[model samples]
Target: MSNLNFTSGQTIPNSVIAPVSADGKVCFYVYGKTHLLADVSGYFPK
Candidate 1:
């Protein structure tokens, strides 16, 4: 995994792949006037 750094007033589209919990939940912590959107492209079986 990699980290993304953004400046103020930056508007770019990015894609990331991360793992979710067993209950299919992901956690995010955002700071200061940010908007987030997520989509699940696919899932893997346990």
Candidate 2:
């Protein structure tokens, strides 16, 4: 898992690679107004 925290009204670019469960779901927790973007590159079997 990966964790990213940013201050209010902060704009930046970030990249993260994390594994997902068999159900293929992701979760995020935020306090205030925030925008997020995600991309899937490839997948590998366990």
As a whole number from 0 to 100, the lDDT of residue 33 in candidate 2 is 74
- Candidate 1, residues 1-46, lDDT tens digits: the string is 3446688999878777778887989877677788888788877777
Candidate 2, poorest ten consecutive residues by summed lDDT:
26-35
| Stretches > 4 Å off in candidate 1 | none
On TM-score, the leading prediction is 1
Off by over 4 Å in 2: none
Where's the lowest-lDDT run of ten residues in candidate 1? 1-10
Which one wins on lDDT? 1
